[model samples]
Target: MKKKTVKQSLAVLMVSFMAMTPFQQTAHGKSTVEINADAAILVEADTGKIVYSEHEDKALGIASMTKMMTEYLVLEAIEKGKITWDQTYKVSDKVYQLANAPGLSNVPLRADEEYTVRELYDAMVIKSGNGAAIALSEVVAGSEGEFVKMMNAKAKELGFEHYQFVNSSGLSNYDMLGMYPEGTDVNDENVVSAEDMATLAYYLIHDYPEVLETSSLTSKVFRPGTSEELVMKNTNGLLKGKSYHYKGADGLKTGTTPFAGSTFTGTAKRNGIRYITVILDAKDKYGQPSSAERFIQARELLNYGFDEFKTVTYDLDSIEKKKKHTLPVPNGKEQEVTIKVDKPLSIRLTDEEKDKVKTTLNLDEEKVNEDGSLQAPIEKGEKIGELVIDTNEKEEYIFDRKSSDYKVDVYAAESVKKASWIVRSARGIQDFFVNLF
Candidate 1:
């Protein structure tokens, strides 16, 4: 009986060890890093394809990384002519108080001191200054509270359905999800999910590259009036030196909190390849040096994408570029007449598969109305038929395997007589009504 018990214990230990070994290989061979964080994600910025992910959709406190949205809004303000770099804002008492408040990052601007929007932005991003964040929020939205509403609204606008906001500065003392009583409906600031961070990062880079320039700065001088001449250093150590040896790793935000752990939205560009990596709640047992872990993961993801996946440009120049035609009906008068694409066009494919993919025309009979006959004369480039590609493969991948059939719209060459004017007008009205809903 004792031997049986010992054998069972040994078996359990072996199973556990076996389970851990694969994860170890994943960490080592794949160059993936595991942190104490709640979630992390790595994506190829060019393709928008996720390369690595773990609990990516799980929401958690985003900490100061909320400033990414802050940066976006500020840029929007600038673009709308509501503000400019040269515009100077008087330092308010609220801004002064927040600046001097204990435990908050600040440049400690005097109430009388003024800074340009550009300077304030530099302070906000370079120092991760809570006071700077609040001041910018107020200057943009009249108050931190109003600015937070903008933040939440922007999250919704960006399709970040998994997020909510309660403060301009992510300094709330409660879980963003309100899991505790301290996490009241208001006053409890929060955000969650590394996927949202990745989404935000993508927009900031693709939609607003100007904001990316600020995060890449390692240090900056805020004001020259001070005795020491206010110098600020970037909180994101990954941007510090060439020692990390990551090319195009520049411009992003980082965050940390007791409840949130560590969070970051980092972007790197190499050659034409760009990638964004978001890590949330990253920490070690001793609670230091997690940045290196994230860097390793990001480097690995970028290398894998660039090395493993080759971008193939299917030379469409060889295929006869056909012309599209318009039908000569009422509104369908010969706008254009075009031939079908007889080949599957692709950007990424091996030499062999690229040769065999052939395009075929699919001209299905027009859909009949209540009378069981075709609708009125078709217009040029109208959706009359389709072009299908045949790859000769049983299974098809969207990009390389086979191109899905596309509708062919060859317009009628003849125009309707004047007697059909009333019918065409009725059809136009019907179309307008149908689209109104």
Candidate 2:
């Protein structure tokens, strides 16, 4: 072949570089997202699929959003019979002083008066009442310190990698007027990653959806029809009748502090889909946005989720291929057993991801023999493996405790009892002869 001129070679190289760029970027590029915060994320509630994220890894002050953990523990205690909604608590000196402390968000409480668990919880969730949270922590754990320990444990069990708890109320230690939980610094504040906060919100709503019944209320009378009647409006401005109300807006929490700046964990459902969004350190070109500005940031994120992505569902039968496959079963009445997902699989995705998603079967290794065959006596409907959904996009998930794969467990389609002894011996002899050959 004749050598090409320098200019001709350069032209070919440029064309080749352009041709390779698209494929390289498709393989290696991260999907970039923009949100009005230091860290933010949007995830589908049911599946925990990360639709978009921006600097979601840093652990920062969460302000009153820390109450979600307290809320979870309270609900769990109620569910476990450790506490009752009507159970009453006398306001301790620390909690009473904190409740009446100037500038703190709280429902007015007098030291002499007793309150019910139900009323305190209402104040905490609906109004982001700091002292109410402290009182409830005392009710659930016998002390605020013990409740903090429970919060940390629950966070770990929920798959949180970055989080810290100094108090049940999420107020900075200094804000607690020397009443912060024992062994914590006066400057300490509850800190958590955006992803972790979203995870907390996910479990809160899923584990006890009844929370929304109160969280969704735009305003409630703290002690309606009584002398202490005071209407408490939800801090989550995105709720209906609030400053930045968005359609489908409901339960969740909002927060602000000098350290956390502004943060919000917001959830809303529409068209049979719900999205959980987290905004940490809400900001803009002008700098730290107002406390309520976090809702605006959340609205933008929820809008992107509700608009850009769509839910795609696939029942086992609807899968075009490989919906069911047979696995070998040795010494059984049947030679093989068919397996499939127990129910439909659903995931949220953008148009691009929808086209790129693929399905795969993963057999449980523990149940398979060395030769990849199952032993006889397989039970019908036994969990055998998982039906996983894969996609090319870089994805984050809230349920890291579960496998990264969005999957449903597969089960055996039918029972396979052991074959007769004579039949097994004959099959073993046939297998020996076949292998020798």
Candidate 3:
């Protein structure tokens, strides 16, 4: 069974678009997206903002897209110095048989086939080659089962809360359930949600960008002397032609199974900005090009995000002008503090609307003594209170506590006496003498 290409299906209607502005910049940006998959999402690779989404939280069978996790784990191993690119891996009979086993997408390998770490990596990522994935997994761990344990461990370390892995190749056979005992079947395939997939894609590209080197290739060939060179072509059709014109459309991975449907995880970089889009269970409607529906939806969302919205940085100065005046403090005070506004508030709105963006300073209500300082020293970086922002009849939200670097010092008792006190005593004595007269 070979993985089939997802053809574009019915055109989906675009609705309820929200335009998010660059933080503290202008408010005219907009987001428009169209998608037909059971679940679709476009996220800012850096901010993890859902530029657009439909059924974004739904968990679905992602099919071979599970390979994305496999790739991530492999890259992580290389990064941690557990393995190297030039490392040699000997093919085992189990992995070799599984790699060559019937699958929709595979780079069949025979026993005794030896490949460098880099060559096998290319086959797995570039060719969507299941054989390559299993072979590499076996080499990294003593066996595929152990390699899968590593995969699950890596997923947990990466904070993937909504996913579980059962195999390295992601070939879960529902039809062949009777082949194994009821309790120990290989049918436990990897599963993930749309949000989880986006998160996975984000970490993969952000942390280990080198993985794309293989996923983005149009084709690849691996040769070890004495063995005929093996040739495999990339299954991702987007790289083969100039259809979307999306800049930086590099490699990621694609997956499909009868039960899981068509899935793709792709990364694109445009104008120094990068994004990862995942479409799970992509189905073809009538008259649509292969994967066209998904491609179109992904492109529109990425474009809207890149074109209309720009990242505007709101520095501490923006917060200072809003009102909280600093009381005099000891020297060496660090007045600087940063507040991260989750979303850009509209600055151009009506005064009433602007006023709605309220703030509450949670300063200590402790009184300052006559010594010109508070009775107790306020600890630096301590949360005295909070600054709350309320906008347009919405909930009153508390801003995070901001701290100053300097501590307050109290005036010494001796410093308040002597000449300064004598002058005060003389004035009191004069008033008393006048009253006696």
Candidate 4:
């Protein structure tokens, strides 16, 4: 009997371990990180370098992930003095009905009651309160219709692609209890690509930064010390004390729906390097929608980013050329001139790729002589060429990798004047005689 009990316990543990990993991998070899989702992406926050991606450009249901755009606009309005944290928003009949709507995530709000912007912001973001989102939108744009316009306009301005917002909230129009913003179809839901969602998250963190203070919170009290008071727990399961509870995870957002499945936009920082990961429509082993698979994929995705990759500095001080780079200064006081690179730069790379990196010196055309030597009368700080660092990686960057990302401009440190005719003539004559001998 005891032996049977022990066997049962071992079976349970093994099942749990295999359940966390939903995809296949190579046997008896180094583990390859793969995500179980319809669309997924991992990007380095500092460099915008794409670490891993699968069908990142495919547009899918975004679910509540649409609120991220709302968060961005709220922060922008505050920065521009259009709104204040202390400002109050009075709930109306529209918000009242939705706040009381069943089978939806919301904080109960009383009609005609005023709630501060700070409170509603927390309710909407931390609790995914549908009614609070509409109230805040009304406060920002005077109506949900105008706010929907603001949401779409902001997406365009931020360079978001494969994205369309029918309402300020990520909730499907049908879920809005027939009160969805005007001019939007009642059957429509917000749609965005995995890469587009990452773009919005990047701008939110880089532009506002303060959103983390609320997003990272595992729980908050909505309308505390009152009859309507309730504790709003963050939907992001990757947060501390949440289901996944990954270390270094502070803030982000998560969403789930019948059509969208489960989607999560997660971010975490370790050793000064932060990574943002998006999992869209994650599923279980049977490829069915799941509530836990999204967070499971998020944990693995963050693990791949923080474990397999690292940030290293590629500076000019350490590189050695085969020979000292020298440029001839014809008819100048000095026969030759030498210039050096300015400084070092930081780059993101995997541990294995560190040894694969190399440096190249490219001389700008027309800036130097045919033989790669500088002519006389070279001015100080003159442009010569660039020092470029190249990394041989199989994956491409998420954005158009800029030359400025890996190349630094080189310039002459000092000026050199032309030599006198007598001196030039003497040198020319001396060279001719030497060659004759």
Candidate 5:
């Protein structure tokens, strides 16, 4: 019997388990911070990894946060060449009426006034202007009703099962549509889960990142340089030096209504890493300390995510370069071919669990020919083996060895061509002479 060394190649797959599982202990531990919201979630912008969650899948009224989707579609339309920023749209009677509605947040627009696409976008995102949002929807899709359909379709396409949008601005349906005709008890408010809202925030930033340019603005005037100048202040309290300002806080939306009670989808960037936080139904009624508890909860979640997790990059290129593994080739011009990992891997982990990370390589020896070599004519990217990684955590753990985690397929680095009979004979003679020396 012999003791195996770390550097030695093993004939069988290797499985190493640590005595103390850091991930399991961390998973079962209670959160240090309390979230006073009906539903809340925090996720990494790049990987979509959920760092902290509480009732994240509960569907609730999202108030003006619905405008995030409208903003996304408007930018998408511009990107697809369907519309332009400078294009002008005349306000309709319905849009005018909605803009001046008693309780809704809006930038007053006269039916006869014409506004550019850019002004409407700025008004909607910066001010949470419901009227501006509906007007923009009508301009893009011919009618607000048609635009709502588009929003729902896009939501479905994005893999959202717990969301429904009845309007572009997240306003209650009864308020926007004027009274249910008959025996209809369903309110026309947009309902979405915190998880889905987080997903939407991620996609909104991922696809049309330019929205942040306007969202980050503390204040701006609609119809600038014109007689009817309307100043629109951003509703997101976390931006700039606002009351609940968090470091690195930037563009995002805030929502509030009697029914929805202060929901927010906030994004921030620090040290090149971005995070999105969604808090729904955060109000003083829920034992929250203040009216601005949604923003406070969001900042707390962001702090937790940044402070607890660290991104780890598995430099597969360096790994492959260091471990020069090769496989013998039979009936070929070359005797062997080099192999390496197919792709690089990166994952987020806590400081404690980082030290437990371990990896193993297992080659499929059965693929080799009985003559102790691979059959020639090997392709450049032929998969010959696999690399398995373990962090001494259960499969259900957050950063376990899933498909999206630290796994890489080993492939042939170069192709191998078949050998000619004369070349094989010459190589044999050369090998014999070298051995004799």
Candidate 6:
């Protein structure tokens, strides 16, 4: 004879319809910050969600901002125990030549001088020193060529499709020392989209948070206690006391070249919320200084992210806490087992969307047996269903077509084992006697 089974119908909860309201202008209306950048983006640091973007995928030269990759590699080396902050590295003749070269931002280094890895890192980050970048690259990878390979490999590993690095620093092939064979017309400049840059910044900060301690420095000495105490000032203008000083602006890198125009990757914290902004190929226009415009654009983007969006956190634990839904177990020692959500969810939304946000839970019935009852011997962590949450927000942008829907797997909270016929009979008799009392 076939064993008996139970079947359950799908449950649907109709959340509020207010979530379907069309997007409307806020009290301040749309942002008036004229983003003069060829490509720019603002992202929440924690969630890595794009808050505001304009031409974010446009490819452009990143200039000195390329050093961010170099910084990442050095930090990685430190983390892997290949190098240490207190360890020292000697300056090579090539590094010396580049440092003394005319018109390049650099902290002067001498062939006879040995500097700590920490000091050189400070120079590279604080001053955008091409020489310091090369010195650190050589120390980490034995040669700048090898370092560039590692950089590209890392970019690929990080899911970058359109970024290329020709040098550890963001210098052009011709400008870099031996970047290309003599007299080659190869345009070997670092190229990346604003989106990729933002992604890179996100990982760099996420993995090595200590980098912010260095990037946020407004000014420092490159060779303190030495005769050649070169003063290194932060290239990012949004730092405190700068011309475009923003209130909460902290660390990040800046870049500019004739070909790349001006670029900046800035991060700031306000009221415990952090934002990262990227501006590439920002040009001087409308009576604004060319180099200064990137900072202004970055400031505006960061501010927009903070002001326009608020975080919404959903506690999945509450689902199990408030009410425990049990699944009927067929031919088991226990008649039912509880279920729970696998993980929590969070999202950022504008005030308008937040006020209208709605969620609904739906269980997938296809997993049910023919009789709608789960089989006994069910594992504690088995995925029995999924919870579907619909915020009712729609993306009208040409780039994104999917609705604001999130799904998380629901799992069995406890195990259930099959019971023998004798055990079931004894349990039924015991229950009858207890109820008679």
Error of 2 at 407 (Å): 4.2
Q: What is the C-alpha lDDT of each candidate?
A: 0.61, 0.80, 0.57, 0.79, 0.75, 0.74
Please give the distance, in angstroms, between residue 205's alpha carbon in candidate 2 and its true position after superposition.
1.4
Q: Candidate 1 on 105-196: residue-level lDDT in tens?
A: 66777787887888888988888887777788878998776787898788767766456666666765342222221213544546756777
Q: How do the residues 290-377 of candidate 5 rate in per-residue lDDT, one tens digit apiece?
A: 3488888788888887888777766444345556678788567777998877566666677766787777666667667655568787
Q: Using Cα atoms with residue i matched to residue i, what is each candidate's TM-score against the true structure?
A: 0.65, 0.77, 0.65, 0.83, 0.79, 0.77
Native-referenced Cα lDDT, model 6: 0.74
Model 2 Cα lDDT, one tens digit per residue, 379-405: 999998777787666655666433445
Error of 3 at 420 (Å): 16
Model 4, residue 217: distance off in Å is 2.0
Q: Which candidate is the best by TM-score?
A: 4
For all predictions, the C-alpha RMSD in Å is: 12.4, 11.4, 10.5, 9.5, 11.1, 11.6
lDDT of 4 by residue, 1-437 (tens): 00111111212211122223455432112247777777788888877767777666666778888888888888899999999999998899999999879988889899899999999899989999888888889989999899999998998787665667888778889888788899898877788778878888888999999999899999988878989879998988888888788999987888888867788999998888899999888888787777798889888888887777667776444366445555678877887766666766777666667787888777877867787777788787787788788776444454544443377777776788889999999999999999999
Per-residue lDDT tens digits for candidate 3, residues 85-151, read: 8998887766565566564466666688677888788877876777677777766776666777787
Candidate 1 structure, TM-score to reference = 0.65
Cα-based lDDT at residue 17, candidate 6: 26
Candidate 6 lDDT by residue in tens digits, 1-437: 00112211111111112212222222224445557666777777876666666655555778899999999999999999999988888988888888878888888888868988998899999999888898998889888878888998998787664566778778777775554423233555677777778878988889999999989889997677879887888978999989999988887888888766678999998887888899876655542226888888788777777777776665444344455578788567888888877666666677677666555545556657766677778888988876665656643221223544767777889889889989878888988999999
Cand. 2 Cα-lDDT: 0.80
Residue-level error in angstroms, candidate 6, position 175 = 4.0
Q: Which candidate do you rate higher for TM-score, 4 or 5?
A: 4
Superpose all Cα atoms of candidate 1 onto the true structure and report the RMSD in Å to 1 decimal: 12.4
